[model samples]
Target: MRWSETCLSEQLGIDPGKELQQLYLRILRQDPALTLDPPVLATEPAAVKHNLPAQVTSFNGRDWEMIEVREMITEHRLVTLVGGGGVGKSRLAVEVAQNVLDDFPDGVWLVELPPLVQPGITAQSLAKALSLGEHPIVPLEEVIEDRLKRKKRS
Candidate 1:
């Protein structure tokens, strides 16, 4: 079955522009077997070390919040830390991701999105972070998803 961007955006409850919709459509066209549900692979021992940065100073207080964040990470696949600039949201996210590194056998990756100027570049940014080269025919998101699926099966 073919899918359009408007249909997908309405189903996902997000308003994507014409360009994003075209990209999504292209991704769907390139990979006919893609689905909303990610494929599950057998669990295996982690082969790579996490890429978290070394702590420069001691983390003081926030023990309660830390515990809660850790629990949330364990329970949820996606977690967002919202706060103003310099409020340590990024630091907390890193700490939480680092703490749960063992939970993800494929290793936790930090895709810094600060340098991204447009929302359309997200797939490209993720692809670059994962060291996957771009393909002429396939969308970046498809390549990234394929790589992630391969990682799960490895």
Candidate 2:
């Protein structure tokens, strides 16, 4: 479900893109009063489990900081790393994921949500990121968790 289909926009005739930009800023401000009509995304646990790959980087102190963060991710942890736009959070995450992709024998997945507006679309993005079968109806997170559980069991 895209944000365009939400009642808030249809009833109020609001442009969701602008609203999301506003909401993103509001979230950055840590504004407690900011209310989302459909409610903003609920934090979800990181799906990372088991061994991680060695991160080998030539960066200096700042790069080291990002590596430290990537190393510190705990099980079921929901980490929201806030930094200036274009400050390389995505880059760091990708670097870490690439380094550790080999640890996940099933496969490593990178889900990009920048284009997503509706909260429901997150799971879809996850499913797509993992390259699941076309038009699967199961929720993305559930499918991911199920696969991880199977891997752990094995």
lDDT for each residue of candidate 1 in 27-82, tens digit (9 for 90 to 100): 86876555467767779764665567878876777888899988886665445577
**Cα-based lDDT for every prediction:** 0.71, 0.57
Evaluated with TM-score, which candidate comes out highest? 1
User: What value of lDDT does candidate 2 attain over all alpha carbons?
Assistant: 0.57
RMSD of each: 22.4, 21.9
Model 1 ranges with Cα > 4 A deviation:
1-47, 63-72, 75-82, 149-154
In TM-score terms, candidate 2 sits at: 0.45
C-alpha positional error of residue 7 in candidate 1 after TM-score superposition, expressed in Å: 75
lDDT of 2 at 148: 47
TM-score of each: 0.54, 0.45
Report the C-alpha lDDT of model 2 over 84-145, residue by residue, as the tens digit. 77886666666665665555555444455664577767666655655555446866677766
Q: For each candidate, how many residue pairs have backbone atoms clashing (under 3 Å)?
A: 0, 0
